[model samples]
Target: MDIDKIRNSAGSMKIADLKEGDQITGMVTVGEDLYMIANNSVHQIKLADSIDPKRIDPTVPNLQQKIFGKGSDSILVSRTMIFAHEICKGDVFEDSFNKEKIMNISIDLLRCVIDMDECFNIIKLYNKDAMSSVDDRRSVDLSMKLPSLGEKAINGETFFRKLSMSYLLILRTFWAAHNKEVDKIFDRTLDFVSKNYRDDERFIKFIQQLVEFSRMFKDWRNLIEHPKRGEYFKIIDYTYAGNNKISRPMFEVVSKKYPQEPVDLEVNMEKLIDLTISNYESLLCFLCERKLKEIAGYTFKVMEIPLKMRRYPHVRYGIALPTTKGPAPLG
Candidate 1:
């Protein structure tokens, strides 16, 4: 409730101090329970089972309230932390370096999602209320210009690129553990997977889907990073084509894979976000299934926060073993 926000040389901050676009560092284990540590202090993390709004102190900022209160898309944030924990199990990364790499990547991925989700929410909110004012329906210029594409903007194209880069980096690191030659480049990684992991049909299919998914955003991602002539994000403003229609604010990015077709930035971004999350879930399940015998005695537990207060990640999970004996079955 009265979570102290302390700034340190390492730039670590607690989950309570987490703003809409703030990035999480890494989580730590304090005894058997999990706590997110800042520079010198550890914040008590509320699992879904323990998250109660009524008990929330008024000292918590409104930003965190939106994130950790009700209807916050924070479950994904929690899932990312849990994902890192679970991913580190069962011989994925043999060394501490790779495991720490996984942790860093997962934390950054969580931040990317936090920024992306908030940007998407803003765009959706503006569009939903666009009809409220005539000017609202008019095209709005994002703060970013073509010359410097790196300037932070609360838009789909920017955050989408962020998410893609992080995902690809994680994929490379993840696969490299299995095959040391895998590179961070997406195409090269795909080539490696295609040739080496071809025996596994599910993995191959996933890689294929991932390739296609990456391609969907490839042109725009590249354009943002390395723009070519005549390639630009059509700002969510007036629909210049139709008969003077006030269009819903959205970005229009042409796919190099589908140059002739028109793509809705918002719609595609939503789909991409869902696909990204599912891909992670699939990867985790794939690994667990691959070692069923080793993990047979463990149970995956998801402690979910109430749906209303799920904005900031409240879910905590782990592969748990039964520690208490139940009554023997009566015969």
Candidate 2:
């Protein structure tokens, strides 16, 4: 799939003009009632019945899985956003913001993009083919809980899961850029980011959200990578809903030393995804400004685009151009 095209379409906020409302909704019929559920993340649902394996073709779920999760994998990684986490944990980015860090971050960024692109390619095919009827759509949604991803869906899921775990690699990659130690010590990294970019409000807020998210999914890195721990927390039923209002109580293990009653807390997956994109875009734009300042030998600010670009010729297509003299249709 085309990475640029997909990335451009991925961001819900960025693509506001392209589409108006949410594309997909997550829900299941329970005793003749439809209850909405979160788009992504593990959920705890009360199961009523069991399925007989011999009744249906297994391959059906495999094909359906793709359609349900058409653009979910578009939650592609942004180096700067993930790097913001590194900053919160330590003064790493600012301290050794060198060529090595830059190169490694660039590689990680490309990997995320490519990982998402692969998934989206499969998802894109599913969307184009499966949008004909309600039964088709129902199949797409139901297959979200299929035990096996099958061959076609497996590759996409593998890459998507890799992106989830890559946040750790992202931190480690930054650490390895300057340090020799291979030990995955998270505290030091957290320490570095907290110290360095403290003054930057946006940076602090961005990292705090991620830090909180990590707290919720504390063992996510290990859980996803280790085959045995893959189902450490059972996913009762998860529907790959679109960029809708998705929030679920993620089970957070409270330390026995300080046991708390509000152990179960909710997380907004949609907000987290939005923050990830925001952090990435914000940091990326900031870096762009820095680079421009360095190369131009003067402060060259990237001001807002012209009003005309936002209004007439840019947004409206196939219109006659207004030359220096007057509006005219060119041959």
Candidate 3:
């Protein structure tokens, strides 16, 4: 395989027909061994080895050294939980921390991505057509599959809560990255962005749009979390009347901001996931464009394994630094 040719390409491509000294980028799993491809060289690692020095065999020619880099600089990668997007992960602009607050910014982003993934999977699994339709007046009893209508409603509410929390986490962590004081409340972050970044119209507008886009979701989650009032989440299956009135399966809730709203579990949650991802990418681009200029010249690479045949420990993604000499063919 011409590994270098597909480095810049998008999506997962089938990787095969690799010779002993093939120049490859990204990690490839063949049989039981893990191939760490970096800087035009392939380092084959045994499945049984615990990353010991003796277990790393430099498959490239004349490179008998270990597979680790000597650089002291740590690279931060903001990657999608799944390998769906191009330019999976790259460096971020931030400083070292002495006083601790929340988790690492990377882990926070990682959880956000993971929460998106969980919501996506739930939507995929539970997005089934209603078993039967009910009359407008008669009450109908229900008995369905393992994940019944009640379970589906619970799943939807849980997903909205998780996604809303993720949205707030992104805002808080992004704010904490720039300032010394950490703001835990969502309202505080919004106030800070509006007050501090008033001069930067572009930044303020983007943040405002994101907040407005996700406001419905946050309000819905609030009802679920704090049900001290009379608000309750309701689920409705397929319903049809004689005069051509129909309503499909939906999660219904009375919004504190607006009137009673019925949200489609499949459609609305997926839209939220897509928007969250786009919002994060836009924020990352804004930060890099505004703060870090010198780190722009560096080329970036990610370690990817095919999602179809994914293994344990979830080898997320890693950065590859260039070496002094080009990789030689294995003799």
On the 0 to 100 scale, the lDDT of residue 268 in model 3 is 65
lDDT of each: 0.50, 0.36, 0.48
Displacement of residue 275 (Cα, Å) in model 1 is 1.8
RMSD of 1: 12.0
lDDT of 1 by residue, 39-100 (tens): 32224454322333453444432221222221223456545645555444544222422444
Candidate order by lDDT, highest to lowest? Answer: 1, 3, 2
* Candidate with the greatest lDDT versus the true structure: 1
lDDT: which is higher, 1 or 2?
1
In model 2, which runs have C-alpha deviations exceeding 4 angstroms? 1-96, 127-149, 169-185, 212-218, 225-278, 284-331
- Model 3, 147-196: lDDT tens per residue? 24555556666776777776776665455456455544556657877888
Lowest-scoring 10 consecutive residues by lDDT in candidate 1? 143-152
TM-score for all models, in order of appearance: 0.58, 0.39, 0.52
